[model samples]
Target: MTQIAYFEPSYTAHNARDWEIRGSYKYPSLLGDLHTMAKITLLMPTLPPETDPHRIMLETNYDVRFVALDTLDDAGDANIESLVEDYATAIANLEPDIVSTLNGRMIGHNFALARAAKAVGKDFVYRIAGNDIATQIAVREAAGRPVTGTAYLATLIAQERYAAEVARSVIVMGGTERERAAGRVADPSKIHICRRGVDQSHFTPAANASKSCNRILFVGRNSAEKGIDLIEGAADMLAKTRPEIEFTVAGDFDPRTEGNRHYLGFHGYADLPTLYQDHDALLLPARSEGFPQVVMEAMSCGLPAILSKSLFEHDFGAGDGVTLIDRDVRSIVDAISSWHDDDSLFAKVRSEAIGQAKEHFDATENGEHYHTILLGQGK
Candidate 1:
């Protein structure tokens, strides 16, 4: 079997244990499927050490390895050279055929990992999860801000470009991302489109689920980028006209009980299915995104989504089961109100969402695509 080293710095010791305990399906499911085809080793940073590697491997049924780097704080200029050497040494020791990591920001741990992959003569694969870097560069250039100077932003952009140029293959989520990567990477042929998938068996439609669009759900960070202000504004406006309508937010933000808005704090992957089933519709007016898994999960559970028009630029929610609106409070309110008023529209959207999830976003089928890509068999 081909050996593959999957570098994911975000999965620290604590969170890795949490994922294992909660039975998080995203990484576990993908890694589990990939394990059948290749010898997969999950490479992560060495944190304060809470979880045992043997236990994690036994419980999660996947190999896990740790490197010297603990966090991004350790990747500063003061120790970057040493960090890269250390990472390269680790990679050489692993003797993997390919080195893969998520998001091509090329900062901190990612920067070190990319350089290390090249140093060991291994094929480096960069998986982009969002268009943040490209979008930021465009915004800076449009604003007449320098993107090539000694500024922090300029340096980060340069690193991102370098990473893209060096990687043997760049995996993007959709055609939109492929277009974005084409401009940065010299070879557009290396850019491949493979979207993340939803486990339809797990996130199924609720039994006898109420089609009433009274409960609105928002699953993301409470940030301006996520359009939290729009959600709150829409909720406050609906509180007066459609007082029965309620907004529930599931993320890391603090809980707030103002008007009809309610926060459920942070929810794990295991808790997401029930949360989606309990809600009537999913609303995410994010300014920018790359195939949000939340939307896929919600759709798999037969919940319709009201998204921002900008997300469609990345080809997300382009088909049925979604209502696209501008990034404003009124637009969001109007979309939710329409769902609440039109019973036929709600039913149609719900059915279409489930159909789309089954047809396009099945995790097992997408996993096969991912396996092919990793094995150098497909783009």
Candidate 2:
């Protein structure tokens, strides 16, 4: 039995249930570990006392364990003198074969677990996300800022440098063209990209049998980076031409920066199925992505997606369920117009997208990938 402790920002999220295992069985975290000759232990640092690994471990057939490092909200908590000691005790209790974080917010827990692993000469890997990477690069490149101004960035950089570089594997999302050209993802063997996974059951689309509401759904944060301008421009164009189509912008927005658009605030991950069901198509012309989870989610619901060309040009783009379009307003409107005019084309692509979602975004498949990485399985 191997114990893997996960450090995360929060436990009760409105996102994926596989990490927390709330509604039903989620295949991302444990099912694969159980399959590939290991007992998986998942420790959520931000969860409550009762749901710790010791108790949560018994709830499933996956042979998994869960533990909480702390209930602290802040990421930069420096006073770990006692927290580290408590973590040490938890590690001893679980007696894991190896330790890893599912996602990279638990740097504090990962660091503590790393120290404990070092004491016994065990190996561990600290995973980080794109936001962390962006922050790190920004800090290094920030002009005239004091050294202490970017302490968080400096701290993570130091940790990576000091720790056995070979022992730590940064599980990043697969690189973009720019990143690949820059050697950000030079060796595939070293870096594992656990990109956008799907909650298939929830995100599958439904038929709009009764009627005449042509709905276009836009999900994701309304930010400049998310390409809100592109969507809005296309929506405006659609409004002028059809005048009957209704466009919705679901999810949160920053009013100060990206300006105002129709906003539905944030919807829980569970609500996505109906959200997609209610919409005719999903519009995500985001400028950048490690992997776009929303596009996959929209596809799983049997909903056709008009994704950004930047994403659809990737290695697996041709097979996935996406109507690739440029960042231009005219392109998106034209693409949607094609989907609207040609029923058979929409039907064929819609079915293909659902198939791709089942095959690629399946949690069981993703969990297996993680399992192999944990066990030192083949590339």
Candidate 3:
């Protein structure tokens, strides 16, 4: 029946606190397919460890199960030795036919599953998000620079080779064309581009927006890669040009930190969509992204964007629907000005943005592709 154990660090959002889960599960169209996958077993690290009926029931995939292990932080300098030891015992106990890890080696619990996959001679299907793979690329690129020269490039090449050498197969969600290109030779046909999908139903333009105020929203963790500082600079410029406009930063937010950013904090799904609806536009200046879920979600709410040139590339085109900037405050300010001035143009852009989200980032389609691959019916 093409039985496969879906290995993520954890099923609960609390444990594997990353962007993938929300993108995968909460996706309206995608969740249904995920629920129907053949014998979908969720193998995550559990400390009090016996598989429970409630856990399986909660996942809504009756075939699901859990396995607990010693907590190891994934962000640390970890190796395969200890991981193999932890999961070899677990896999022997569960006896799954195949193992597929979403976050791949970058996550701690999956490290264990991957090790077990190797020792038991089972298929190990690894999946990686945009950041981790791109980080490796950036490293290679930096090494290729004049200062790093031949020696550094040679060393990084070996490391890259080592990467391509391991893993039975890999799945990558390409946020950019560059990412797609890099994955081509990573492992022959083993490395496939599993595109990300977005939801259109919930993100459509709000009917109650007539009562909403003029505001812009930026949703993400407060990090360097998110371009929070750049947004603040742009907001600073907006403050001068249109004193009536307000900017809000949502998620991993601190009021004291973002100079003038009004902190809305991390809101649940019910509330977040409203924020997007209420806001006039979405601002995302990502230093890097793997088809950012936030962009799709915002677009779904009919909020046009002012994103980095790095973001609005390819099928994700940069039209008036997007205000593409070179990480400059003035450019961001200009986008805001233009959107504010023209009502018809703004509406057109907003409509296009929603259409694009429906076409591209729907998780339901992505999940169907996932099922196809695991079931040997590759999309």
Candidate 4:
């Protein structure tokens, strides 16, 4: 049996203070499936380290073992050198055939894993997310959020570049990410495109199915890259022309949003399916993304999407169940109006969205494919 070590920086939710009770709705379908196929050891970094890292919780998969390492500060930030040393120690203990990392960015823990793998002469697999350098610059410009320090950002960028240079293979979340990684890596042949998947069984359509005809939803982090300001502008425009159309921003969002739309505070994984069912469509005008998991979950619930043209182009190709538009107030307003005006188009989009989810977003299939690739069967 092949042993694979998967490393993620943090598993804590946005609002949750404790780690044990934190929700993991995203992992069960994919990670659970992986556990049955291969021996997966989930390695995590913890602040104020948990005493019993080996204790199996009821919510965690029995087959997958959990391991936690200590970070330097209360913020759970581990230096790259220390992280490399820690990962090397874990590799010595786990003796994994393949070392894989989910977030392949500079500050991401996986970068350290990549370095450790290189040091130990082990195969490294990097899973690239949507947050590339361009997206980081866009987020900094749009949101005014600090990009770590200038020096730190540079270090992180170099780390990611080194990872791409040395990784035996790389898994990109979407075509856009693949293109971005290809621009940096020496061997483009090592890159593969893999979209994010959802648990269709958990995100089923509503049984009663009494959703309003013109209710629109935006579910994501309240970051500038997620186009929260654009969502507010669109809501304002719709409130004037299409007063009957209601807009809601679920999940973590700014409560101080200047609009007449409903802002439901952050909803965890357990409560997201019902939240998706409550809305008629998903309106996401993100500046960057690697196949937003929320979109797959919403699609699994038979909800159509109105996404930014960039996101649509990068992930869902044309003829998919998506209404693409520019990330602007007018474009969002027109897309909503069009969805409301055409009955046949709306029906087709919804039906196709569900069909796409069933066909492409199956979590088990995603896990199986990753298992094959990690085992060197597909390479």
Candidate 5:
């Protein structure tokens, strides 16, 4: 079997699990499928001093080996030279044929990983985890900071450019990324679009239950970039005008409960399906994204989504089980109100969401695509 080392600095005991439990399973599912065809080694950074490293290995599936880099920090950027040397040594010790990593940015960890892979004579597959470099730069520019004026921004752009140029192959989430990669990568054919997949069986719609457009769900980081502030504004406004509509916020954030707005704190992967089924719709007005797994999961559970129009227009066109709206408080409130008022529209959107998830976002099918790309079978 082909040996492959998959490096993800963010993987930890909380997210890595052999069984279907808490947190997102995108990585674990893909790695599980890849393990069937290859000897998969998941390389993760060492956990914090208080956290137990052994828990990660114990929780991970027995088939795939979980190796923790002791020298690397949580962000994978401590002591750059030493981290690179340690990683290169680990790559040599593992003797993997392909070295794959997510989010190949200008970050010291990803850059170091790429260098280490090249040093060990392993093919480096650079996977763009989120929005591409160009899109990120655009976002930064829109925020009033010119790339030329910022030294760190310049360094990031240059490093990402070099990483993309040197990678043996590049994997992107959607068309936007592929188009963006074409400008940076020398060979357009090497760029492949492989979107994240959702497990239909695990994220299915509620069985024998009636629908109610009262509860609105928001699952993601509680940051301005994710448009959480918009959700809060909408929620506060709707509480006064439409007392029936309520909002549930989930993720790593503090809990707040005030009239029609309730924070449920963070939930595991196993708990998310029920959350989707119970909620009427999903709201995510993020400033940018590669492809959101929350949208897929919510849609798989027969719940429609209200997303940012500008960010998702390229990926989710018209009638793709998502209602595109401007990233503003008024737009969000209006979208939610429209769905609640029109029962037929809600039913139609719910059906379309389920259909979209079943047809294109099946985890098993997407996993095969990932496997093919990683093994260089597509080329």
Candidate 6:
């Protein structure tokens, strides 16, 4: 079996059993399907010494060999030299034929892993989920927050450039993301698109449910980038004009405080299916995204979405099951009203959304594609 080392941001607890609990099983799902084709070893960071790095779970079917490294976290740590040495040593122990690292925070890890891969004469693959630099800048700009320091920003930019340049293959989220990364890479042909996959079978809507189109749902972080203010403002407007329409929020942040919106608080991954059944549509006016998982989840649930123009152009782009609108208060109000009143349009978008979900966002379909990419068998 070909030994492949997978390096990514460590999930909470640094184990496969906790991935579902953390609502971050994308990596597990992606790797599980590919395990049959290769000898896979998952190298995680920020785990304690007590963590059993070799533990394997029966649920994932991946049989991934876990190796925990304590030097991944630089949170207020001053010992940079020690961290670099430890990271390189931990990676070297794997003796991998291929080293695939997730492009995330802690720039030192990328450098260490790249150096180790080079030393071992192994190919390196850089998988990018979201650009931290772009997201941070966008969120701060959206919230009217001031920039803290240039040092951190410079480091983030450098990591992005370095990762793209050194990696043999670059896996990105979508077309827009590839375009953004093309500006940083030597050869754009090295970039590949592997969107975040969804479990369409699990997130399906209830059968034979009547359509009301009055219950609107917002699922994501309660930050400025997620357009919490827009949701709040739209909720206020819809309360007066379309009093029947109700808005519910489900995610890490809470937006309730003498308002018309109902906050469901932070829900686990399991609760999403039932939550989608109870809601009519997903209303998210986010500022930016690298193909949000929530949108894919909602579409899998056969729920239509109302997204801002910026998000629509970047991810959806006139896709079914979603209606694109600007970030104006009145635009949101009108879109929600149409979902309730326009019977023909609503019916068309609903049917198309479910079909789109299965075709584009299904995990089984995407998992196979990624497996091929990992094997270097496709374009």
What ordering of candidates by lDDT runs from best to worst? 5, 1, 4, 6, 3, 2
| CA lDDT, every model vs. true structure | 0.73, 0.59, 0.61, 0.72, 0.74, 0.71
Candidate 6 achieves a global lDDT of 0.71
Model 1, position 294, has a per-residue lDDT of 88
Q: Residue by residue across 133-247, what tens digits does model 5's lDDT show?
A: 4445655676886654576666665666666777888888877667767887678899887766888889999985346578899998664467777898999999888899999
Per-residue lDDT for 1-379 in model 4, tens only? 7788877555552224234323244344445456656687766664223343423441255476667755432212346678778788888777888888643343346667788898887889887766665567677766666665676578667777888788888887777678778977989988886654777788997776533458888887767678888888888887888788888887655564345688877776678898999888999998877778888889899888998886667667555778889878899888888878787777778888888889888887876776666667785
Per-residue lDDT of model 6, residues 1-379, tens digit only: 7778766566564345445433246555566467777887766664323443323341246666667766645522354456556655765776777787532444455655666566667777777776555677767766777545667677666667886788888887877778888998889998988875887768896685446688888887766677778888988988887877888887765546455688866667777888887887888887766777888888888788998776456566564778889988789988989878886777778888888888899888787877677667788
> In model 1, which runs have C-alpha deviations exceeding 4 angstroms?
10-23, 47-60, 63-80, 102-106, 132-150, 316-319
The C-alpha stretches of model 3 lying farther than 4 A from their native spots are: 10-31, 47-57, 103-116, 133-169, 175-191, 195-199, 208-214, 255-260, 318-320
Give the alpha carbon lDDT tens digit for every residue of 65-107 in model 3: 4455444434233544566665676566667667775443443
lDDT of 2 by residue, 202-321 (tens): 566686421232567788765555677777888778777876666778776542222223557666655668777877677878665556567667777776778777655663466465
Put down candidate 1 lDDT per residue, 1-379, tens digits, no spaces. Answer: 7888766554443455444432345465455467666776655554324465443553457553444433343555566677678768767888899888632333555566678888889888878777665445545665677554547666665666777787888777766667767887778998887766877878899998886789999998655467787788999899999999999988877877877888977776678889998999999987767677888889999998888776665564545788889999999989999989988888888888888788888887877887777678966
- Which residue pairs show backbone clashes in model 5? 22-269, 23-269
Using all chains and alpha carbons, the TM-scores for the candidates as numbered come to: 0.86, 0.70, 0.78, 0.85, 0.85, 0.86
How high is the lDDT of residue 216 in model 4? 89
Comparing 3 and 6 by TM-score, which wins?
Answer: 6
* Residue ranges of candidate 6 with Cα displaced over 4 Å: 10-24, 46-60, 75-84, 101-112, 138-145, 148-151, 254-258
